[model samples]
Target: MSTELLTYLFVGVTFTLYIGIAIWSRAGSTSEYYVAGKGIHPIANGMATGADWMSAASFISMAGIISFVGRDGAVYLMGWTGGYVLLAMCLAPYLRKFGKFTVPDFVGERYYSQIARVVAVICVIFISFTYVAGQMRGVGIVFSRYLEVDIVSGVLIGMGIVFFYAVLGGMKGITYTQVAQYCVMIFAFMVPAIYISMLITGNPIPQLGFGSEVTGTGMSVLEKLDGLSAELGFAQYTDGSKSTIDVFFITMALMVGTAGLPHVIVRFFTTPTVRDARKSAGFALLFIAILYTTAPAVASFARINLLNTVSEASYKELPKWFSNWENSGLIAWVDKNEDGKIQYTAGKSFAGKPSFTDERGESGERLINNAPTEGVNELYVDRDIMVLANPEIAGLPGWVIALIAAGGLAAALSTAAGLLLVISTSVSHDLLKQNLAPNISDKQELLAARIAAGAAIVIAGLFGIYPPGFVAQVVAFAFGLAAASFFPAILMGIFYKRMNREGAVSGMIAGLAFTFAYIVYFKFVNPADNNPEHWWFGVSPEGIGTLGMIINFSVSFVICHLTAPPPQHIQDLVEEIRVPSSNNAAAPVEGGQTANA
Candidate 1:
């Protein structure tokens, strides 16, 4: 079959499966809608979390980021995977034991303040939507490029698939589907990576392949990459150009932000026991590592292969994928010397590198520009296209191409469902039913949850169509917001009994406002626009999220110390949430015996 037909077949089949799962497992009650009736198995929750965590960015964009950024890209691999360790160890079990449907519930009940819940809701919406927009955009790109659909229509289709299950099955239905998505996405990501690795380095393990010797060449892949990079004036492959302090802070911020994300935290609530939650987190990371470990290898291999193909070649003779990507505006090529050959060379470093001169001896730009180049030089490759372009880059079969398309959609949709579920429950269960109508019936709450989830999907879909920026950068924003506003509040509430509602609320506002302002100023206001001088404190907008988070923690703690202690009842509530007794382990509701010992 033609690649187009195969793409349609695979995508159609996957959609059918998701729809079928939704129909068969339709939610019947508020419990089912919100927490999958709080009956999800630990392993199942782990799988779902894996799917939810590995958005289109993870599956498609991560390797691309690594491809272009070189050494600094390790921060993502370290920060993202390392954060899971923190979640598994410090956050997941305790939160699951708290047994709330949403992250804000813990914040509100633990702080003994409804105001804290409101602040949490705001943070959740901001972080989740920011994250969701990237997923949607990823889906759109996959569809537009592979299946030949319009970008907007692709986003709508992805949104519709998520809406079906997210509204029909709620958390319960979405959970099982996400498990399936995890399987499909993982398989799709690893197969091409493994093949490419073996082809390039004669190594089977993608992670090790990164450092392994290139086939028929005695040099290690990293060494070769470093040599190639230096030839073009770029830094060595494994050594970073950014300061160590900046990289340290960026990694720390990502770790804290990952731990604080509402949708991820809420996954633990479905596990049956505290131990289960911990085990589930471990399982989730294990599954996630399958791709995370392989991603760097994919990036390295693709970079080498592209350079090998394009270097010293005429522009019109470029590979089909090159033109395809160039047409998409993700990859650009310029013939600086009019040599009919694309020359990629490292330009002079601004600090002290040699300045260039034209034929007339007038000073010229530091670099010759093009996608494929001759010596050490500057070359621009869009990181977002790395994964999607991998199958073709490696000359994989057409079926693999179609499978990747479906897999990318699966990754995006699974995360979208998870985020929409949290958005729905936060609104319907926590805000409307809890605050708006205490007497609301379970049936009415279920309907409300569905409506809220559907509405959230629509809003998220729109943002995907008109994405504010790159997938990884947008996702980093979500992480920063989560780290700043939610992480500190939750930690203080659980670990420090002296923490008051006023302190938590103040901290959240400070974190959220500061992070948002910083992003706007650096990313949009004054704008970096590819200029290095625009960064503040050597922190790009992506790294600034960490600064926002630190500011949040500092402000929250300072405010808490200045405030009076919580009232007796609130103190009792805090104590109750800490205890893991089975009787109190049931979902939180008014008039229930406090879980406090």
Candidate 2:
């Protein structure tokens, strides 16, 4: 079958499976809607959490970024995975022991203030909405390429599917769906990697292949990559350019943000016990590592393949994949220097470039670029297209390409659903039922949650259609906001017995305001001011969250010292959460009821 037909078949089958799972797991009550009735198995919840945590940036863009930046990209791998260890050790079990349906619920009750709860809700909504926009954009990129639709239409289709499942089943539906999504995405990611590895190094495992000698060249993969990079004026694959302090702060920001993200934190709430929550976090990290480890290998292989295939090749002699991506506007070649040969090199100038025009004669011929210039650098490649285009570039089978399409959609949709759920619950449960409408019926709350989820989907779709920045950039900002606002508050709530509502609320507002102001000023107000000279203490906007987090901790501590301490009962509650043995294995239901396991 053709690639298009194969893609349709694979994508259609996966969508059907998701819809089937959603229908089967529809939530009946607010408990199920919020936390899957607190009955999900540790292993299952772990897999679901893995799926929820690995967004489109993880699936589609991570390898691409790593391919271009080499060792400098290790921060993402370390930062994201390290955060899980923090979650497992410092946050998950304690939060699980608290037996709350939402993060805001824990914060509100712990601080004993409606203002604190509202602040937590605002943070969750901001973080979740910012992150969900990227997922929707990932969905659109997949659909637009494989299904041959515009990005807006693709986003609408994704919104429709997610709304059907997420609104109907809530967390219950999302958990089961995410488990399936994890399997599909992992398989899709690994298959091409293994194939490419075997083709180049005679090894099936990509990690091993990366270190093995190339089959014909007999040079180690790293050595060959380094040589090619030097010849092409690119950075060596094993060397890094970022300053040590920047790397440290960026990694720390991502780690803290990962632990603080409300969607991921709420996953632990679905587990039966504090012990299970810890165990589930381990399983989630293990599953995430499978892809995380493979990503670097994929990056190495793609870099090698791309350089070998494109370097010094004439425009007319370029492979079909070149033209395919060129038509999609991902790859552009200007034929600078007027030599028909395409030059792939770093620091190629764009001065005196000519306008592109079709030069086909009556014979109906076509060329990628009709413009010619004196510049040596002639091509522009977008990094975001690397992974999706890798299989095609390597001449993989149509079915394999189709599988990738399904996997990308799965990765995007699964995370989008999880974030939308967070947004929905924050509005319906935390803002309305808990604070504003304490007497609201469970049925009314459930209805409100569904309505909120639908609205979130629409808003998320709009953001996808008109994104303010790149996928990875927006995601990093979301993490920064989470790190600054939520991580400190939650960490202090569980660990500091004397932490009062005044301190916690002030810390959250201060952190959120500081981080948001820095990101907006650098990213939107003055893009030119984002350089090192303008940055505070040489920390970039992405790493500014680390500073913001410190500010939050310091401010909160000073405020706590100046104000009254938490009440004795509240201090006892903090002790209760800290001592996991005091709580029951199963989460308590409404009205302080516990169901039998």
Candidate 3:
């Protein structure tokens, strides 16, 4: 079959499976909708968690970022994986024991204040929307290039699919649907990686192939990539350009942010018991490792394929995938020296994003009005397109390319469903039912949840059509927000019995405001000043969340000490959650382990 037909087949089959799961597993009550009735098996929930955590950022854009940034990209791998460990070890079992439907539920009850719930709700919505924007835009990117549709249409289609399943099944449907998605995502991601690895290095294992020598060449893949990079005025593949402090900060921010992400945290609530939650966390780490370990290899392979194909190649003679991406507007060329060749040197191709005219140049290249920057580089390839285009770049089979399309969509949509569900819960359960209309029925609350989900979908669709930055970058900002706002509050509420509502609320507000303002100023208000030179204390916008988190902890700690302690009952509850009882010999212990005390 043609690649197009195969793409339609794979994507159609997967979509059908997702919708089928949603229909079959549709929630019948508020408990089911919010936490899948807390009946999911640990292993199944673990798979779902992997699917939820590995959004477009992990599945589609992570390797791409690594391919381009060289050494700097390791921060994502370290931060995200480490953060999950923190979440599972430090928070998951305790939160599951709390038995709340949402993070706001835990916050409100723990703090003994409705106002605190509202603040948590606000933070959840803000962080979720920001993260979902990346997932939706990733959906658009896949559909735009693979299905040959505009980004707006792609996003609308994605929103419709998500709306159907997410509204109907809620957490129950999303959880099962995500199980299938995890299978498809991991398989699709690995197939291409394995194929390229074997083709390039004669090794079947991607992780091993990353270090193996190139087929019939004396040098290793990394050596070849490093030499090629040096020849083109770029840094070695093993070398990173970011400062040590910046890397540390970004990693720290991502780690804590991951720990505090509402969507990921909610997965723990679905497990039947605290023990199950801890078991699922272990399962999820095993599943997540499959992709995370292979990402670096995929990055090196893609960079090698890309450089080998386009370095100083004639525009007309370039592969069809090059033109395909060009037509999709993800790749732009200007032939700066009138050489009619595509150059791959470092530095920006222009002062800003390409402002393409409707006209074609002499070599049939799309004309860009953007002024050329001081660089010999003549190509502008979107990093988001790197992984999606990798299979095509290496001339893999049509089915492999089509599978990539399906996998990319699966990754984006799974996380989108998870994020939207939390957003819906925030509005319907936290705001309308808890705060606004305390007398509402369960049925009424369910209806409100569905409506809130629909509205959130439309808003997320708009963000998808008009993303603020690259998938990874936007997600980083979301992580930073979560780290700054929720991490400190939850950590204190669990660990510090004296923490009051006033302190928790104040810390969240301050952390969120500081992080959001910094990101906005650097990412939106002054894109020109987003570099290290203009950063405060040499922390880039991406790493600013770590500092924000510190500010939150400090503020919360001081205010918590100054304010009156929480109610004695609340303090007793906190102690109960952390301390294991003798009757329960295998009770869930602190840091996600079991012990008889």
Name the best candidate (by TM-score): 3
Q: lDDT for each of the candidates? A: 0.79, 0.86, 0.90
Worst 10 residues of 1 by lDDT: 348-357
Q: What TM-score would candidate 3 get against the native?
A: 0.95
lDDT (10s digit) by residue, model 3, range 324-407? 787667877777787878887977654344454432432224343544656788878788988899999999999999999999
Q: Model 2, 1-597: lDDT tens per residue?
A: 999999999999999999999999999999999999988998999899999999998998788888888998888888888988898788988888878889999889889888999999999988998898888888888887788786789999999999999999899999999999999999999999999999889999999998899889979998989999999888898899888888898899989999999999999989877778888988998999999989998988898889998889887777777766655445667755667777888864342222354542121112334434444666777677778888988899999999999999999999999999999999999999988899999999999999999999999999898876757667878888899999999999989999999999999999989998998999889988988888998888888889889988999999988999987878877776676564455443324444222
Q: For model 3, what is the C-alpha lDDT against the true structure?
A: 0.90
Cα misplacement distance, residue 305 of candidate 3 (Å): 0.2
Please give the distance, in angstroms, between residue 117's alpha carbon in candidate 2 and its true position after superposition: 0.5
True-structure Cα RMSD, model 2: 3.3
Give each prediction's root-mean-square deviation over alpha carbons: 5.8, 3.3, 3.4
Q: Report the lDDT of model 1 for residue 76.
A: 79
Regions of candidate 3 where Cα sits further than 4 Å from its true position: 351-373, 581-597
Candidate 2's TM-score reads 0.94
Question: Of the candidates numbered 2 and 3, which has the greater TM-score value?
Answer: 3
